[model samples]
Target: MAQPFSVDAVVWDMDGTLVDSEPLHERVFYATCRRHGVDLSDLDAGVFVGVHQYDVWNAVAHRFPPTVSREAWLADLDAEYVADQGSLTAMPDAQRIVSTLHAAGMKQACATNSAGVVVAANLMTLDILPFLQATVTLDDVKEGKPAPEPYARACTLLGVAPERAVAIEDSITGLMAARAAGLHTIGFASNHHIAAKPEFHVLADRVIHRLDEVLSLVTMPAAAR
Candidate 1:
């Protein structure tokens, strides 16, 4: 393949985009809520899927009050996630895309709404930590997804402008952040929401169901070769 346009960097969102961790997280979150005797029976856990952790608490505070404080419930969930980290798996073709891009010498960074601890845990579990040149967690920015700060910070840390980079995301929150940061966004519609909620994925410059498809989009036009 010959090259015309080149992608200088890739900003990734880890949970649902790169790994099948969101389902596990959803189960753990509800289980922790029940352990504390918080009733989430009425609320569909899916509603909280793409929201930031801090915002999730705020959104569910009154309706799903846990026996412990908000932070404690989150701590419990995080610990459960760590304990079950082994159950997590990389999304189909996620490792392939990352490895291929890494081999191609493109810069990469992970910008996740999750805190550094969870981010590091999953990255290590997937053995993808080495391929990523940088990681920007919620701890690294004033604001996380749905806000441009996290993605922008990732671009800065990667030494690339947002326009020169692309972001692979699986949800509205992260896609909004990437678009706002001035990067081309690819929406991974591995779940129903991304495929069904066309209005929600409006920020995505392109939408693909599989992670491997990203390679073709990021690379140059075929005619250029």
Candidate 2:
């Protein structure tokens, strides 16, 4: 079947879509929470996968009985993630798809809820930073995923309309933002949370297993090329 419209660009979610940093993030969040006397063991850290880093911290902070301020926890978490940059790993086909899309002349941007520090570190780790036209994070907008602002900011930076772009994400929150921006959406089931959450899949037009499959699903418009 012909695509409804040629995909002129792609906006991707960072953590699970392009890079498998969920485990690393989870570990760090859990560790940070532990230090603050907040036990996240009972709560699924998976729920925070695509949420804004500050929001996550605030929520955890509210639940914890820690005497330390949330700002202190944020500082400590940032320090740890910077020191443990070794934890980031590219998802399957992340390189192949990104490189191919760049070569095809598709504009690309990453819309992530992670902080700039983590986003920069992961992009550098995956070696896809140079391939992207823009990167939008919590710091870039007043609202994060589940809010259309981040994706809207990304589309604006990429100089593309949301309807002409495809958004690939791993979490419902990310998909919600993409959909709210009127972008076509694909769910990358690389995160374990994808299985536990059926409603997330319902938000996507299609769910893909490997990043390379994105190449099969989209083609940059001739004008962009």
Per-residue CA lDDT of candidate 2, range 1-225, in tens? 535336788998988888888888878888887877777799888778788777787676678665787778887787788788887788887888898889878889999998888888988888988889999988889999899999999999999888988899999889999999999998888876564588777898878888877877886779755
Error of 1 at 132 (Å): 0.8
C-alpha RMSD between model 2 and the true structure: 1.8
Listed in order, each prediction's TM-score against the native is 0.91, 0.93
Off by over 4 Å in 1: 1-5, 64-67, 220-225
lDDT of 1 by residue, 1-225 (tens): 423235688899898888888888888888887887777877777777667788888876776544557788678878988888888898888887898888877888999998777887788767887899999988888888899998899999998888989998888888888889999888888778555786556877787888878888786323334
Candidate 1 collision pairs: 2-225
TM-score of candidate 1 to 2 decimals: 0.91
Q: Candidate 1's C-alpha lDDT?
A: 0.82
Candidate 2 matches the true fold with a TM-score of 0.93
Compute the lDDT of residue 8 as modeled in candidate 2: 87
